[model samples]
Target: MKDSEADSRSHKPCVPFGRIAVLGAGSWGTALASILARNGHDVRLWARRPALAEAINKTGMNGDYLADVPLPESLTATASIAEALADVDAVLMVTPSSTLRAMCEAIKPHLPDAAPIALACKGVERGTGYLLSEVVTDALPGHPVGCVSGPTFAREAALDHPTAATVAFPFSYEDRLNPEKSPAARLAMSLSGGGFRPYVSDDLVGVEVGGAVKNVIAIACGMMSGAGFAENTRAALITRGIDEMKLLAQALGGKRETVTGLSGAGDLTLTCSSTTSRNMSLGFQLGQGTARAACFEGRPVVVEGEVNSVSVTELAARVGVSMPICETVNAVLHDGADLRAAFTALWARPIEAEPYALELSLAHPSPNLPLQFGDT
Candidate 1:
């Protein structure tokens, strides 16, 4: 085929959904809304700030969030929640982890029946220790929920950089793995398109655990990087981080290999290394001995890993998981533990096999594991 023909074929529209609503106007949310628009879906974005909505509607740009990129002319920005939710095919929830539950409750009354809800945020709820999806399920019962998670950084995913994420739910039976036999599986496959390729997996526990815990690990890697550690040290932190991730995921019924896949290791590598990652960047400053205020650089946004570390460590204790690395991170960030001391403590710990001292807890049914996320 000619190059032009190939280009045309690639851009050919997927089956259209009538309207799609994105609930947040942050960088990731705007980027995803743009992707849906580029894929030939009508999209509406709801921003809490009227000024942002007006700028996007009038200038055809969202310079603050998605800097220097022109938005699709067809994309609508609305300040009112009702206007955005009207006749939407799917609702993309991109709010912060801390506020996700309240955000869902606010939007629940306006959601269309049977509309698929996709989560674009990652983190464990602080007080409840519930994964983000658990909050969604509690708020919107019977909704076909789906999650989009991977190593995607917003700037890259927004720029149409090649990225892949998984769309998963609870696997009830083995027969569903056969694409020909399972409608849910088929439906999951049907939704993969544009720049976001979706892998279907039955291991929702693995997916969520990998997504949540990786952020905490990214912070640890950042601390090492900030302290002028060499690449070899960085790699060790990442490998050990995966060890903890596997233990936590397996405790919650996740497959061990899932932690080795893109959502786990791939995400850990990207977030830990990139200055764009809020968690890593924050850690870099802390390593440099900068005050917390200056480290924030006056941004009002929250770095999830900073607060999430405390909660995750607390929950890990309940399961008898010895997360020394995560506990060390918690100590430095909150307890004023010496950074060198924390790092040294991890190195000095007695050696054992992977998941040592933690495997025994998974022997019983533990509620810390998220039972199921929505279907793709």
Candidate 2:
């Protein structure tokens, strides 16, 4: 195999934690567990079903969702949520954005000693449109919260396909991990394998915003592609997508750089263009004029963007940001706006000189200067 391919097989190591818990048993959750085990760490995958846990432990594989690839032999599974959390040094929460609060509440008594909690899920809360990081922080007071996201697809990660991601968390003012010296930072530094690369940032808010909003934009791209629209139109949608994402990220006190990095622009590019993405696939079907219920037939996989569309629209209105693309998506999906009519409505809006990036900062509460991404 080539060097990149070899790297994909099992990357290097900064160091390994004693134990880590992955709360969800879905495809993405399973893939992350496999990655950790491949890098020589102890990983505990918690599922709600005893049968599923037994299948993984006995067969050394996930029988569903992630059946496309065999799970690492070293990976373990458990049905008890506490059993998974006990003795763990870190927690990787991979549950759906909507279910995050309840899951954390259930595991509240079991939370270990300030272990870093990494969020791998993306989406705005339905009623409040809160980002995953915000929800985690609010639910688990004083805990070290972080998030990881980008153009990652679970099947590709399993296959060791070349991919890049971003890891963002508030830098501890006291126990800050020196990207140069701290073992945890170094371990995270070496976490990327093969075609997988992970970039570390201190901009938790920015990373969260990028991950959450990209799904919404992917739906728009899917619709355009499904409708056989030209590249020029898709380009317009993507540009507007970035603008809307930037507007919200700024509103939520995120750094501008975070939205421009791997997790932001990079992720947007991949999810919007790929037919493989569930969000894009759903949009494509919608654009092709398929009824929502008919196109979603038997596909239970979470597209994330479908649900985020309305939340994003509401957020834009609250912040007073103009997001034509997001508005169009919300109209089509929720307000029963005709697909073609919605698209046309966006074009019908007035055009003006592009707003300066600073306008976004003016739209929300000014945020503190970011420490990590600023100089790096």
Candidate 3:
């Protein structure tokens, strides 16, 4: 096992005693709520549907999302946003990115003034092209905002399988050095224990970008897999996909190392390789000649990649970054471009030097002009 993975699995019981409100009782939200409850925090999971909330409250199970996994008896469910947010020490926003702003607005009246808010949802806002953290910050100004992201699958995490995530906040250098003194660290402590580990970071932008962009890349990898491509093809797509992620992250004022860390490369690797991922599964279905409408005909859960492909691509374009894979995914999913033709065109583009090498050359241009050298 990797040292990081091993470190994440080591038992560390530093959970702060408090009440945590987890908004959006979907699969991911429910799983996270379960983790907090198991760690001895008083966790309340909020479901939009009153019936779902009632069911979970009575039966200790979320039938719609996590039908098989039984929730902790200590955990409770509520349909009222006010009830969930009342007197909570911390809040975790796990709703879909498309609806994150509305959720934030709903909780504005009830959210505790000093309670820290952490986003577990992954996607760039559709119409605004804003990061999820940005939406939260806009909605709840003056509150400490952070995000938790990584390669965690909800079911595995709920079942106590070892899972590690990066918990990030916009910390100053001093705050980064003394993470334990910040709200982000307190939030991270709440998420730690019971085999679920969280590493604290100050690169909030990088963590958010990594979590959001990986879904788009996962869709590309899924399309390749569903279209009968071999491992070599998937490997190539993943490697190039990291380049696109790093470029986008760096362009957005995030560190490149953060992109290469858990939230970026780690999340991409897991999402691309697993059909359990909603984004990957959707892409696989599309690649297998299924109509996009047919793919979502019965599925009730939100497929982030389908939505993020558009926003991520648009954001990249606005920043003048080239992200062909994300652009191709967007075209196929939303712009009515043929899947096979898109892949073909993507692969047929003129080969250039690696992105890193290109970046190096751009940063340090040659002093002598070609004409000057020839004249000399």
Top candidate (lDDT):
3
Q: What clash count does candidate 1 reach?
A: 1
Model 2 Cα lDDT, one tens digit per residue, 109-164: 99886777888998778777677777888889877788778888898887777777
Q: Kindly provide the TM-score of model 2 when superposed on the true structure, using C-alpha atoms.
A: 0.86
Model 3 lDDT vs. the true structure? 0.87
lDDT of each: 0.76, 0.79, 0.87
Comparing 2 and 3 by lDDT, which wins?
A: 3
Model 2 residue 245 CA deviation (Å) reads: 1.1
Candidates ranked by TM-score: 3, 2, 1
Off by over 4 Å in 2: 1-16, 175-187, 355-376
TM-score of each: 0.85, 0.86, 0.90
Give candidates' CA RMSD values in order.
9.0, 9.3, 8.0
Judging by TM-score against the true structure, name the best candidate: 3
Model 3 misplaced regions, further than 4 Å: 1-17, 173-177, 358-376
Q: Name the runs in model 1 displaced over 4 angstroms.
A: 1-17, 171-194, 354-376
